[model samples]
Target: MATCLASGLGLRATAWSQTTDGQTQAESAKADPSQAEPSSGDTSSAVKSDTTTVTVTGKKKAPNDRDVYDVSKDLDAKTGTAADALNKIPGVNVDPSGNVTYHGRNVVVYLNGRPSLMLSGDNRGVALKSMPSAYISTIEVISNPGAQQSSGDGAPIININTQRNMPPGMFGSLSARYSSPAGSLETAFLGITKDKLSITLIGSYLNNEMDSRSLSQTSVLDSTDATLQASSSKGEGRSSYRGPFLMANLQYDLGPNDVLAAAFNYNRMPSDSTDISHAVSQAADGAVTNLFDQSGAGRFVTESAGLSGNYTHYGQKPDETLKMDGSLARSASQNDFRSANTYLISTIPGNTGTRIQTHDRRNDKTKANMHAEYNTPIGDDQLTLGAEVDLEDNTINSRVFGPADNDDNLMVNPLLTDDFRSHQVVSAFYATFQREVTPRWTVLLGLRGEVLHLATNDLTYRTKGNINYSRLNPSLFATYVISSQQKVRFNYTHRQQRPEASDLNPHIVYSSDTSVDAGNPGLKPQESDAIEARYEFNGKGLNYGLRGFWRGDSRTITTVSQIIPDPQGLGNIVTQSTRVNWRRRSAYGVSADVSRQISNKLMFSADATLTQSALRNPQISGVRSATSVDGGFSLNYFFKKGDRIFASYKRVGKSYTGQGYTTGSGQANIQYSRKLTDKFDLELMVDDLFRQTRTVTVIDTPLLQTRFVSSRQSPTFMIGLSRHFSRFGPMRAPAN
Candidate 1:
């Protein structure tokens, strides 16, 4: 099924206590020097015996295993969305399509230390692009997740912390942004609290228009290693996204240390795109064979809604808590596509005609989950136990229509029509123990066991299948304090990524007349083992960290493409692609990050990484390895009256697959934010300053080879205005 699974979505309450207290910790350390950790070479902890107190503030916080970056201090929070803000953070990249990565690796996302259906699977990209950054407080990156965290393909985790549910008061904010090339965004939020209850509501709408261009060349080779047929094509397209998003949260204090919470969220987005392409095909003798013109139009709509409830009880002792939560979510999507292809010149008889094709697809999904967790202190150590269960159901209907025999009427193509239904159940149990091995050393050990049951029915094919599997995952975390200002951490984890619903369905779908896609129902899950070590230093006005990571994966899933005959018996060659499990793969990388406050009003930060990745399979070639480098930097200057200027640039490294590789891409952006009044703010920004972002891919195989390049050059000029208000008092100004 199309399950929106968020690892530990409703549990993992301890993450909040450990990661969400940056401001609180800073305040405590400021108020009392004794509350701060003493380090031999640290200047921030310096204090006189009887006289003055010193307070040092930083833009980010690192507590043992994770790094938390304050989002409100950046200008993007005023002019952009959460996706835009994430692109500015070190070691983090949010691509034009809203895919998020850390150090060239996929990352699972969470909201406020808990998993949310909206932030899982395909929905995550849409949410990140549509959600306003004004509602965010901080962004947390967990390099090596502990056993307590949900695992996905052994990738890291990123948590987006939103500002909500404040003390007894009435608070709210409204923001609007307009951009050239036809784009607009609007956000509104309101919160009310009294006595022991708090309620929050957030709403946002985004309408963005963009243009894209792509060029591709494909060649078919003969037994003598000579090209038999070759084709080249160029396509131009325009697309837009328009959507409204709504969310509500409720929290109530049942007693001194008890709380109850409920949350509801709904989102709907409709998108459309149109593209035209011109292609020419040549024979081995370089003779023109066909000149083709193709035009396509597509429309897609997606809607989702979810409801969740939680209960928490805190014990008298610190870090002791019991939590339980459950959630239900439903999502639906519809896709309609139409395409027309005309051949101006052809070698075959009666081939200079126009062909029309249409596709209609609809998918509906429902998911329910229950989770519970308990954390307690044993002497000076900590122990946690948790359990969770999830259930998912999905239904999909797909139909393809092609030109009828000799007539203009359309007929349903049986080979490309299908009805699919799937149901899945997953259960997991985990335990983690933390202990202080010494005054300067700490360790955490964890183990998790999970069981999955899946069943699918293909009514079109009259086939039914059942799959079940179980596995154990383990994780370890250790940290040693090297000095007052420096420390070292080591981590190890095991993770798995299962095949999604689309990957498990055995239906052949046509992307174009010359391209087809399908799935393998017998594919195995991918598994990975990862280890990492990091060294961190917090100096007077400079902070830096270096991390080295190594990972090995088995049963790695990779795409494989081959030349095949056209399914319609049209005497044409087509590309058929599917996913398969590779034998092994390994990757190792080193990354570094540094941040400094150059002056009272100026701040600078930079990061760089070097990676060596390799893939191996027995079916074809030997081990293939690639080395790549990635780097980025940002500069922020704060002016009087809460005005700020921010500039940043980032580049992603190249990536490789079994038969192909994709080149890297880069972009630069600048923004200006000004406090116009006590309650109003203004912002101006420019994105893709140099318009240097593009994707280039090459695939070489024995029978077929292809090269493709895609570029989207939309340099955005945006202006935004926001306002803050509170019924109880004037809202506090944002941090810089």
Candidate 2:
């Protein structure tokens, strides 16, 4: 199609051309079809009735892999830990509590397309918090995972690709940073690559301290709908952490089509600190019901080590492949806690002294996983088959000494002294088919079947529980190209969330002066059915995406709080928080992301998400619904003087959970970098610009309502000097 000439006399005309097909012609005049004939001789003719248009494209269309993004190119991230860098990703959010979510869905984290034993269980956040970002080459957030992924359906997956085939020869980088709230961080990366072998080492040392103050106001109502007690407590404390982390990977090309890789991970937090807090309570009539002053201090020492191996056999066919991965890991932790309270009010019956309690916990965990996948082409369709086996054995020894009871015996709660052991095993098999049914349509179908065996024993309580179950999960994905530059996708999957060992422990621990925390042994696993639809567009230099998702879950586990008589029998009342399963839970949301480069020197990007979540249970609060909105933006500028400035801001809305709710806070970060030399750079960074990222929560329960707030992020300024050495090859330059 072509357009020419304005419908006005003496109108100025400009010429433009776009290629509709591989054809070109210069027509001198319109002729009757019956008399039309080609000129046999002189092709030199300079008369035309209409101007022809043609367009040439310099590059092929971008690939349809919407789930992958280049870490360095997409996010102008400086040298920082993975936790500090993840905030720059689109549609990814990390809350104040170190929980990572993608589009309001729980995200499974992986390493090099496989689950690493180093990141087993609830340690992903810890790994990200300490591991340097330099170890990562790319971060792939799979929004619609297929059957090859052993993870649950509808759940997102984040695969952190390690630095493969390190810059030829020997190269390394060193950086050190100092933060206000968090102490000092020093990290280094060393890589040696020669021929078909590559070995890389990355390590970090961190010594950080966090100080925060929180105020919790609680109201206890009686059966008559009258406030029986009102408790307001304000506490302040500080916790310091010092640790070291090291990870090494070795890769060797066994042959033209096979590769073997081995890696090891180790991290330790051996330093322990002491913290104390005091709380005072009042009555509903504004009287000093309990003037008890309580203080507690705790110490924790934890260490983890793991080793893994992976082998990849790329068959003769480009896309045919077989992969095998295996890993084994062990983590150990020890905790010692003690608290003392002086009753300014009256003490318990037959007692004239304050209360003292001590709790000690020793935990050890061992895990092993083996997985294998085969990828092949079946005619015009692609097929993937995989199997995985996971085994975990955990043991926890706990002992607690409570306050003196009426009989002068302080060890009143027998459940506090228990030895918990848990053994879990899972075997799974999955199959996936991706077929290009037509030129413009693709369909993906996957099915997974798994058998789970779990056993738990409470040696002290003389109780045990066993579970044996099997489940089959099916998923479907459909993608249709609306045009050369636009596409639409739909996906559905089912996922399950089982209770961790800690969630099933029955040990009682006092989290604060007025709060007693415990776990439920009879807790059930949660399962959800999720579906998503996404539309994507690619223009000149801009990318845009919109997605909508909904999930329905049953047996949702959540923290439930209630006012109860002091289990320690020290008078007054206290709040007890425990985990419970909800009858039903559901959430739905829409999200959007945009990336555009306005010019060569400046660029801007933005993302927004909105969600509505609701939960109901007959045993907890009746039913509640929460709606939230989250949005963020960033700006980057590259100056001609070999300098760069990057700034970002994020404002997240409220997040909902069973029995309680929390509101997200605003966060901001900025950085400036100067290129001192081709191999060395100087940079300044700042975090928590607003210094107001706090965890604010509200617990609306049948017997009590409480409001609490705790600081998460603090204003921190840091200066770092980085040096890079590329001996065998030149490296990619930083932003500037």
Candidate 3:
């Protein structure tokens, strides 16, 4: 399926707040009515009351700088991760694989103000899938980060704010949820606050399993339109994961003007998966020519831990502050895979050739980061200066064995093992200034300079080298207020994505019986220039927005495939895929979103987007592009006694990648929730009502053409119950 239509009428009333930042709104007064002392920027060294203070009102409000999503207001979930919640936000999209895109461009995710090691690489999707959304109080979507944010702000950013001031007592929450595919989630939160110290703890566990099946067809043809080889196969696989995630934070008030904090996070995931597929090849005359069957099973385990500390001092003046944060982390992973295969000709009743292979791989990595920023008021403008340093050390090893009793076949593919090591260091400094040119206009500009060094070595191939590159990233942001309820913003930013260590490892992986994949150690980093325009309107209980963006990439890394002659020679060849530096790529898109309250009991929202992307393959001297249209709508109904009913449907269009083009599709969900009591609730949900979720891929070339489809068309129903208790008193509606 390349596209799907999803439409639904919703009923329910909701409100949107014009103000941003919980600390700047009146809700803080409702959350804390104890006449407590001020916390944010109360830079008075000596104070009488040592009671716990709230920082929600910190610094001065930045009215024209960023867009903020108050998670508490827009979503109320008994069970779901931040990734799920983020998918519901306007102008944001999260693919089935949990890759997040904002305005048609990739974004960097941060916890508080620091980079989250767990939210990068494969770990990003998994960690976000398991992370409890409740831990994040707010999400700031910064389209143009200032120099003070340095490297992190270079690209669009998703900053998760997890810290909240605690009242003068101990409190927390406990929750458990179960879903389809035999998946379960459990979480606990505990916080304690004294006169001068605040302690918070979070613990969670996830046990999940999922399965899917697929069928595919492939044909190899000559330039004369004659089919040389045709094949078909059916495949299925199941995967399971069990893991524990934990975090702890400690904050102490050194005085009224300064604060000290430390935090630690850890997680371990153990997984198992298996797959099997069989295919038969036919000649142009429909005669069975060859048979191939393959099966594999594998186990993977990963572990990560991190510790960090922070010191913040609010200067003894308005709009002045100094903050320093540092963190260190370690992550390690291992995989063991085994497979068996058989190949035979039509004339042979028994297998002509057979082989068994075992593959083992391990990776160990360590990361360290430090950041410092200072902000002060200069005349009517604000200036920020910042510096940061990041370091990474990684080691990987892979080994393979074939046919316990065979050496002839092994020698054909002699290079079967390798040890790879990589080291990376990055240092950056930046400066930013924000000026209010007039009563209704604001301008901001920043520049960041970064230096990066990468070194890699391959013991098996005796190849070693070092790479050094540096660039200056600059950004500009401006806001023009048309009125109290209307405003327009313009933003331009430059960002970079460095190639991962895994991408630099020079090792060949037999991904399939007929195909192999390898990395390119000489690959360079990719850079992007992004520009966007946005307009927002909010008034009379209505919220609407429009946005457009264009992003261009240089030296983009892409995968290209070619037929390699098999060393066994028997007049056979195999397909091999390798990564290389592509010439360039570009994407641009426009989207709009509107949410309105139809009545006291009915609310409706809708969003649509159109995007086009193109890439230039320097190796092939060819260029290809694709366009997609995606959209979704939702309805909500609120009844008495805190009861609600909701319905929604979303569709995503096809995506173009270096490998091939993917299909587009969507799903529908209907849910009803009832408040059994003031602190207890029940929910029933029917998801994928139409079973429309399907995956399809296509690859076309002069000599080969292949198409594969995996239809995950299954209906699921779930029932959940939850209980909540809070001594901190009334819960304010989350900001929108």
**Per-prediction count of colliding residue pairs?**
1, 7, 8
* Cα error of candidate 1 at position 247, Å: 1.0
Compute the lDDT of residue 303 as modeled in candidate 3.
83
Cα lDDT tens digits for candidate 2, 228-262: 77776677777777789899998776754567889
Each model's lDDT: 0.75, 0.67, 0.68
Model 3 clash pairs? 10-635, 11-636, 12-602, 12-603, 12-636, 23-56, 72-734, 73-734
lDDT of prediction 3: 0.68
**Better structure of 1 and 2 per TM-score:** 1
Worst 10 residues of 3 by lDDT: 4-13
TM-score of every candidate: 0.89, 0.85, 0.86
TM-score of 2: 0.85
Whole-model lDDT for model 2 versus the true structure?
Answer: 0.67
- Model 3 C-alpha RMSD vs. true structure (Å) is 8.2
Could you tell me the lDDT of residue 462 within candidate 1?
Answer: 90
Best-fitting candidate, scored by lDDT: 1
Give per-residue CA lDDT, model 3, range 126-235, as digits (tens).
67767777666667777656555545333677877664555556877777767785777787777777766778888888777767687887777788768887778888
Which segments of model 2 are wrong by more than 4 Å? 1-66, 74-78, 95-97, 104-106, 116-123, 144-146, 151-155, 283-286, 347-354, 402-413, 506-510, 619-622, 713-715, 727-736
